[model samples]
Target chain A: MDRKAGFLFLSALYITFFGLPAASLAAENICHQQGLEIRQAEIRATPPNAPVTGGYLHIHNHGTSMQRLTAASADFSGHTEIHQMILEAGVMKMSPLKDGIEIAAGGHIQLKPGGLHIMFMQLKQPLAPSDMHQATLTFDKCGDVPVLFKVTKTPGQSDSAGHSTGHTHQH
Target chain B: MKKIIIIAALFIVTLIGAYSLSEYIARQLYPQNTGARMQLGSPFNLTAHTGEAITEQAFQGTPSAVFFGFTHCPEVCPTTLNDLTNLRDEVTAGKKTFNIFFITVDPARDTVAALRDYIPYFGDGITGITGEEEAVYALARAWGIFWEKNNITESGYNIDHTATVFLLDDKGYFKGTIDYHESRDIALKKLERLTAIR
Candidate 1:
């Protein structure tokens, strides 16, 4: 009994000291490869019959050369494309980016609502809240960056992110 | 004395012309409010998500919040519907009977089955409307709503549409509109005032 009690105490101490911080760190949802970092990666949960949904994230290129995000593939979607949604004079217009997006050296690009995002078309199944999806984002220079997107009901309501769609970065 | 009288007459004429021009500009700019209690839509037949044939009479008894969008829409439609759900809960508090409608612009894709599965994700009491393309277009035209489809990929398309939510009174008269991305506080207040109308 004493040995089991000691083990449980040690586990609690370890969780308080190490596990909690890791949980807090997960709020950023970042993936890094070859000096390219993707932050706040998430996919929006959709209604069961929705034909399409959006994935948003921020890309930071720390390398000295420009990188082009050319393509993306999601395990849950049959077709994935980089698309842009423009809200001009209360009209929302969306179009695909044929040439992909360019990230300058030491510059940042954000894929957000009312702006650039990943369009997941023909979903194999409906994405539910708290579900994690695996997607591979391919870049010209970085090859492929694997990311895990946390499915959220609202745009930025995952973990402690607390960033709502209403506050998406507007540029 | 004659010269003074002529100058006063010219000054009065300029004032009158300026006033008339301003009034004309106001009327041109805000034609929605100028008409006598703007009529919302003409009689039309459409299928609800419940698979029932409905007409404008469905909106005649209770104040309705109608939004024109499609299930394929990724961002705006879902966000607006979610916002409306929360706002309705807060504004009504289970006391008011407010109706919400989600009318699809892409009628070809948003069939009865499609909407039946989609509308339930949002809060309850929202009726999804879709019908033949021509009839849906006619209904949108009557409400002064605009929608157009743009082909991005060979097999995929997106729509450019008005994201405004139209508010109608219990008598089916157009009351006002809630613009997309309008402040939440203001939208809540608008719903409060709208539901208060009898």
Candidate 2:
């Protein structure tokens, strides 16, 4: 979790909503293996033919017991799912977790944009921030990692591989 | 130990049958998902990413802000159209003249040039409605709105909507609904009570 203090706390939230400098998209956001470390892995662009896009990252875990992330894969969208965005009675719902998202043993989970996201879904093309995708998360015991996704354009712009409180683009 | 009370009574009857089948499929696909205050969102004739032909009586002499997202919905319809264009630029900072309609309940992939290249990036006054899909499903069934499209063997098969952001009035009616889980000071006090009606 000391992963460069999570990309220096997501480059101070991409200098408060895209003043840029997510440190060149979080210094080449990696997929290193140590106890699950994958930070600043963005996606967000979608609106030139939008179909679905939103994947933010930060996984930490420094290992001990609890991990789970279950699934996620990408070669530039078709279906990725993970979604959370709660709120319930006050409305704002967005469900689809289907058993994945645990973390807790040492703890760390971010995946921003309105709360725990990843949903790349069906977007065959058009997600430019000059594009650069990869995504591959699956973990129940730290197996698949993949990570790369760095196409920022607002929505928590490029933390590339680090940050925490996702308020990166509220309007 | 009687098999721990028969495995805690079969885990409380499978957690009440998965909470009454997910509360009856969330009351049959979100009956306004209970945040209530519905009714009012009819009358339509979309098409207006600039090609004109809008209606609901040009938002009838003022007070507007209808939203029923799409354009591939990459996160709660652009975070509920950037929280209704930041409560319509903090209560009409353009000296009052609100009018936020962004219709398109997926008008066959939001055409009209994809809502004129997507509602000017949540700035400006914002107006983007796409037509014909039964006139955007009769303006999304007079606003009870609830899209579906679901998992369809996956391939980006996603649609599940109802992100709310209503608040019309000025004779267009339905004077409620804010939820993007509220707060922009409760959605600018519900868009200052719908631009103080009238």
Candidate 3:
């Protein structure tokens, strides 16, 4: 076989053995709501007795217009809000985003630990690890986007997408 | 040019000599700066998560890492506690005794039972402390921790608090601190130094 054809054959073989499995594995975590794409959606696993936890995800606006996530709800939580955590002058301050998080046209945003995240309170049941919990995210224009957030012990544990913010100590 | 370089070197040497002399005298005057034990924080009467009365004495006999936060805290508190658990394990490795103290800033909501339910997610070797609001705040003050309640909602309120984790020696003397979201490597090094202090 010619070098170019041989390279194509090897590339196909490599993709079959490596790329397919990863894509299929993460397929369950990725969700699509019309023009919006959500990836790496997960809820932090907390103690069975704990009443609160946090959820994280990445939202990409694949369409030509902007989208705003106004609210989120889960069957296991009585109260859910989009909250932002910021470190101001050595103080850790958390505030709810009542106006919601806005994603620009053709842009993306992350809701990760130590930054913006979904605050789940009054939990009816604990988020056990590896368990998938159903949640509905309400957007100003997109209506309701249903997602299944997999419970994880640590950030990026199930996927290699490292946290874009937080978890750093500058000495 | 050689003479100029020699003169510059001599000036730096003289500066170093003067600084060393001042540091020596200061250490002589204050023995605590020279490896002498210095206690920190005041005695406190509080309740542990185990539903038992605890005092500052519990912090003695073992090096401890203390943090102040409430159970209602969504991200910072739990994230810090989780990081502490992993860093402590890496530092201690079951070779020595190192305790972690989780002091609640919002005592009104963080009862003994509340802490018990919340702290278990970070694993063992953690002692949760909660009591009357005034008493808890007093203890936090003694340790140089500041907190304020804000954004009151119908459900509850949020607390703005210092996110530094205090490190103390076996004698309960202040050693150092690990800032919130501080790099894990530096935090691990601080814990190692604290554990080695005994």
Taking every candidate in turn, the Cα RMSD to the unseen true structure, in Å, is 8.6, 22.9, 12.9
Error of 3 at B1 (Å): 38
Q: What's chain A's TM-score in each predicted model?
A: 0.73, 0.29, 0.73
For candidate 1, the C-alpha RMSD (Å) to the true structure equals: 8.6
- The TM-score values for the models, in the order shown, are 0.76, 0.32, 0.76
Off by over 4 Å in 2: A1-60, A63-71, A74-107, A123-171, B1-53, B56-58, B67-69, B78-100, B104-108, B111-128, B131-185
- Write down the C-alpha DockQ for each prediction: 0.52, 0.17, 0.35
What is the TM-score of each candidate's chain B when compared with the real chain B?
Answer: 0.80, 0.32, 0.80
Q: What is the interface RMSD of each candidate, in Å?
A: 1.2, 9.4, 2.0
Order the numbered candidates by lDDT, best leading: 1, 3, 2
**What does the lDDT read for residue A29 in candidate 3?**
34
Query: What value does DockQ give for candidate 1?
Result: 0.52
- The 0-to-1 C-alpha lDDT of every candidate, in the order given, reads 0.83, 0.71, 0.81
User: What is the lDDT, from 0 to 100, of the residue A149 in candidate 1?
Assistant: 78
Candidate 1 whole-model C-alpha lDDT, 0 to 1: 0.83
Q: Grade the docking of candidate 3.
A: acceptable
- In candidate 1, stretches whose alpha carbon ends up further than 4 angstroms from where it belongs are A1-34, A157-171, B1-36, B152-154
Supply every candidate's count of residue pairs whose N, Cα or C atoms clash at under 3 angstroms: 0, 8, 5
Clashes, model 3: 5
